[model samples]
Target: MRTAYSVETVRTAERELMDRLPDGVLMQRAAAGLAAACADLLRRRGRVYGARVVLLVGSGDNGGDALYAGARLARRGAGVTAVLLAAGRAHEGGLAALSGAGGRVVEHPSDTSAPFDVLAAADLVVDGITGIGGRGGLRPDAVPLARAVHESDAVVVAVDLPSGVEADSGEVVGEALRADVTLTFGTYKPAHLIDPAREYAGAVGLVDIGLGAVLPPVAELEALQHADVARLLPVPTGESDKYRRGVVGVVAGSARYPGAAVLAVAGALHGGAGAVRYVGPAGDAVIARFPETLVHAGPPAKAGRVQAWVVGPGLGEEPGVRDALASDVPVLVDADGLRGLNAKVVRARKAPTLLTPHAGEAAALLEVPREEVESARLTAVRELAARYGATVLLKGSTTLVADPDTALPVRVNPTGTPWLATAGSGDVLSGLTGSLLAAGLGARDAGSVGAYLHGLAARSAARGAPVSAEDVGAALRVAWRDVSEEA
Candidate 1:
């Protein structure tokens, strides 16, 4: 799994590593990695020799790193120019090194002796306006320079982080640099993994500076790898029987929306469950499509034994919701079933509870605006988990799973495409995760693995074309095989 740390934690780790090393050892190491990455990029364009390299130098360590890297490029036959954002406060040693290595230094971008022309025609532009310590956004004076870089065709590379983004919260308050790649040091920052800021920070490259031993093992955010998901997947054993594998009970779909039942059952069928017992008004519709489903008309408790229950895909405030929630089996709540949900009842249940809410549903649950929930997805998901005492999966551009326990790391799904925004996709996800829960995986594992498979299936099915919710459900088996067969 790939992990990311908060800015404060990274700073602490960097300090500890620096204390044991020489004064400029860490900086030199960082500069070396940055220069190598720049050289590689320049080499890709043909040759590093005579390549125009422009560095936007600020007053921080980030700027110093850029300056030293510029010096390296100049020494290697690249035409390097440093545009200093801060004149007097710039790193003296770095400036001298760049000048000594035959690199030109320009003081800001003015109408007279401006480096705007150089920046426009440069092969590569390195953004060093701000680092992890920067808050809000870019300064007023630097906004024009940032705009100019964006308008240019240069492949922008951000040093450490894109300027004007909050490091810890992944929030882009105002103007920020959009990089083709970000070369981060020591460890991955929160901005590198989370959304908004992550979108601006295109492809991230970690430049290890020997701070691994000093950094904490716990990561604030984690993206599950193929190996991690494979381990959590349930596989049938020699001793496994129909009853032994697990049964998932789904209470979904109303007469008004029978398609919800079909989509949900479609996902449940592929979720490694031994059997699916569906209890709802759309039993006829479900039986018409999938005759294998055990259909019932009444409450979920009377729908025979089930290891896990999925309620509320198209259910319109039905009484069956109460019966399902009251059952001893693990329960997954989604769509209309999540409406007017009682937090106390969910918390009182002995079995695990998983809540799947999109931004609008989550907003209703939290009594906040939909925009608020969408903008602050991390905070909304975490808050929902704490309040309802259940595992919360907030689905959107990025899917995040948060456990009720705050100490546990939140899982962010890296797989997914914009095509997943189709209607009824969440229904499919709810059923799939419910089946996994019945198969004996914990709430967190079920949610994370289910999301992983769901997103992968969507991508595989679409393959760059527009796909419906049904296509996503049908591709589940393909996704399962792809993960299970991995060596």
Candidate 2:
């Protein structure tokens, strides 16, 4: 699993590490990593010896890292130029080092035309305009330079994080610089994993600087890898039977939307559940599609025995939502089932409850605008989990599963394709996650592992082309085998 920490936690760890090291030693270590990454990028494009490298230097340690790195590149016979946003306030030690290494410096002009010419002809641009602590976007004087860098054909590499993005909340309050790759130091930040800010960070590269020894074990965000998901997946033993494995009841669909029931059942069957017991108005549709499903036409309580229940996909005005919630087993609520959710009622339940909501649906539950939830997904998911006292899986480009416990690190799904935005995907996910719950995984583990498989299935089904939700459901077995193989 990959972990990301808050800015405050990372700063605390950095301070501790720096106290034991000699003066300027830590910065040099960072510079060495940054320069090596830049050299590798340049080497891939062509040769690094004659590459034209331009550094967007600012007034803090971020700029100093770039200046010292540029010196390294300059020594290797690359033409390195440092475009200082504030020449007077630049790092004195770093400026002297660059000058000593025969690197040129160009002060950012008020007119901005000179920098535009330099940026246009550059082979690579290192963005050190702002560090992780920067918020509210770039200053007015720096915006034009940022725009020029964007217009240039150079490969942009950001130091620590891209300028203008909130490090802790994953929020881009104003215009932010987009990078081809962002080289973060010590530990990952929240902005690198969560959306909004994550989109600006094209590809993230973590540089180890020995802070792992001092940093806390628990992080602000956790992204599960294939091995982690594999461990969480339920595998049947030699003594396992149909009932022993687990039964998941799905209360979904309506007369108007019978396909939702079929899709949900498809996902449930693909999940590691021994059997799927479905109770809804679309029993006939589900039976026709999946004859293996045990169907009932009434309340979920009468749907035979089930270890867990999935409620609310395309269930318009259904009475089974409350009945499913009333059950002693775990329950997953999604789509229509998410409407009019009672926090007190959910908190009082003996078994765990998982709520899966997209941006618009989450906005409705949180009583905020959809834009607010989308802009700050990390905050929205965490707040939703705390408010409802349930696990929340906020589905989007970057899926996040937050546990009710505030201290636990929120899990982020790393695998996904944009093609997952197809219809009925959430229904499939609800059934899959509920099946995991029935198989006895905790609410957090079930949601995170389900999302991991769902995303991988989508990617396999899509393969750079448009794919239907049914295609995603069909590809779940491939995703399962892929993860199992890794384990």
Strongest candidate by TM-score: 2
Question: RMSD of each candidate?
Answer: 1.4, 1.0
| lDDT of every model, 2 decimals | 0.90, 0.92
Candidate 2, superposed: residue stretches over 4 Å from native: 109-112
Model 1 TM-score on a 0 to 1 scale: 0.97
Among residues 3 or more apart in sequence or in different chains, the pairs in candidate 1 whose N, CA or C atoms overlap within 3 Å are none
Error of 1 at 117 (Å): 1.8
Task: Rate residue 361 of model 2 by lDDT.
Answer: 96
Q: List the lowest-lDDT window of 10 residues for candidate 2.
A: 109-118
Q: Residue 20, candidate 1: how far off, in angstroms?
A: 1.6
